[model samples]
Target: MMNCIEAHGLTKQFAGRLALNNVDLTVGSGRIVGIMGPNGAGKTTLLKAILGLTPFGGELKVLGRDPWVSRDALMNDVSFVADVAVLPRWMRVSQAIDYMNGVHPKFERAMAEGFLSKTTIGREQKVSQLSKGMVAQLHLALAMAIDAKLLVLDEPTLGLDIAYRTQFFESLLHDYYDKARTVIVSTHDIDELQHVLTDAVFMDGGRVVFSCDMTDFDAHFHEVAVKPSDHELARTLNPLHERHSFDRSVFLYRNADVEKLATLGEIRTPRLSEVYLATISNQTLAQKGSPK
Candidate 1:
């Protein structure tokens, strides 16, 4: 598979603070990859670099072109949607559609209109008159109608209710995703978004701590809820993370003996959130010179 975005020795500084610290990342084509991290982890900065919206020191490429140097040409095959409230509050829905038609060469007026028709939003309604959910819907429709190969979303569903956030990703999965297109999303709704991701990347302190394909997650990571009697035995095997749930002790392990874990208690696959927590925890431990 070809990579849609590539970065090597990517560094970005803001006010003498490193936003991206010698980052290296690769996003393969046709993959729905999630960028998971705490705030200040350089998730937004990385996305901006890929979109050519920020200047940085590094070798970075998006869609086979240097994004910062050739942003105009790169944007022809790229589309972006950020958090809600970006639209002009005074603009009417129809005017917004017209503006997109005039500005983006790949935008399809009919496609955007078709998506809006499914909602209660009226063409004459101003953005301020619409609810936050409606604004997100409009933004998503506009971006989806564009015939772009790479789509970058930076917290696109932030601040919305669960219903609207769920709907946003559903539309992307069903209405816009295809094998020929690639999407990179940075979101806080990890558990909700994990199901749609083909790949996952975890970042911390402006560096990528862990990355893995969802298909290989089960092979690389494992979780077991050990019985009270087996907690010490499980610890002897060196679990990456351990937490208590009533009487059962759930342990997360990496490249562990699955068959041996099965003898401990209930062996189960780890969720993305679990794996992410373990990744960050391990990084902290390693930095502290403690055993992971």
Candidate 2:
């Protein structure tokens, strides 16, 4: 499969601070990847670089073209829903469709209208008149109507109710997703997206600390809930992270002996949120211990 995005030694600096530091990443076609990180962790910077919205150092390519130099050409095959408010608040639903149809050659006006037809939003309603959830639905409708190879969504459903958020993802899966296209979403709602994501990229302190396919997650990481009596035995395994949960100690291990850990306590697959928290915690501890 061809890679939709490729980066090697990709670096971006803002003023005197590093926003993206020597990052290397590859996103292949036909996969839904979730980019997770805290604020100022380079998630937005990386997306900007990919979308050619910002200039950056090092090699980077989107759809086999340099994002900086070939942005216009690259955009022909890429669509993005940067945020819920990207669309002009003054634009009416009909005008939004007309504008997209006129601007984006690949945009299908009928398809966008088709999506809107299923919603409560009316063609005469202005974006400013719609609720936050309705705005997200409008944006998603426009994005999904584009015949693009790669789609990038950054907090696409921010400030929406759970029902709307669930509808947004469901629409993506049922109406837009296909084997030939790729989707990359960056959001704080990890648990909500856990089932939707085929792979995950965890970033911290302007760098990617971990990236893995969801299937390989269990092979690389393990989580065990152990009793106080087994804490010593669990400690001998050198867990990446540990924390107290009610009466048990939850230990996170990386490439550890699962069979041995089974003897410690209940061993089960860790949720994406659990793995992400443990990974960030470990990174924080390592940074603190490093010489300044």
CA lDDT, every model vs. true structure: 0.91, 0.91
Q: Which residue pairs come into collision in candidate 2?
A: none
Q: Model 2 segments beyond 4 Å from truth?
A: none
Work out the TM-score per prediction.
Answer: 0.95, 0.97
Q: List, residue by residue over 1-292, the lDDT tens digit for candidate 2.
A: 6699999999999989999999999999998999999989999999999999999999998889889888888888899997787789999999999988998999999899999999999999999999999999999999999999999999898888899999999999999999899999999999899889989999998899988898677787888989999899899999978989899999988889888988988788788898899889889989999998
1-292, model 1: which lDDT tens digit per residue? 6589999999999999999999999888999999999888899999999999999998998989999999999988999998986889999999999998998899999999999998899999999999999999998999999999999999999999999999999999999999999999998888898779999998888899888898777787888988888889999888989978998889999889888888887778888899888888888778789654
Instruction: For model 2, state the Cα shift of residue 39 in Å.
Output: 0.4
Residue 143, candidate 2: C-alpha displacement in angstroms = 0.4
lDDT for model 1, please: 0.91
Clashing residue pairs for model 1: none
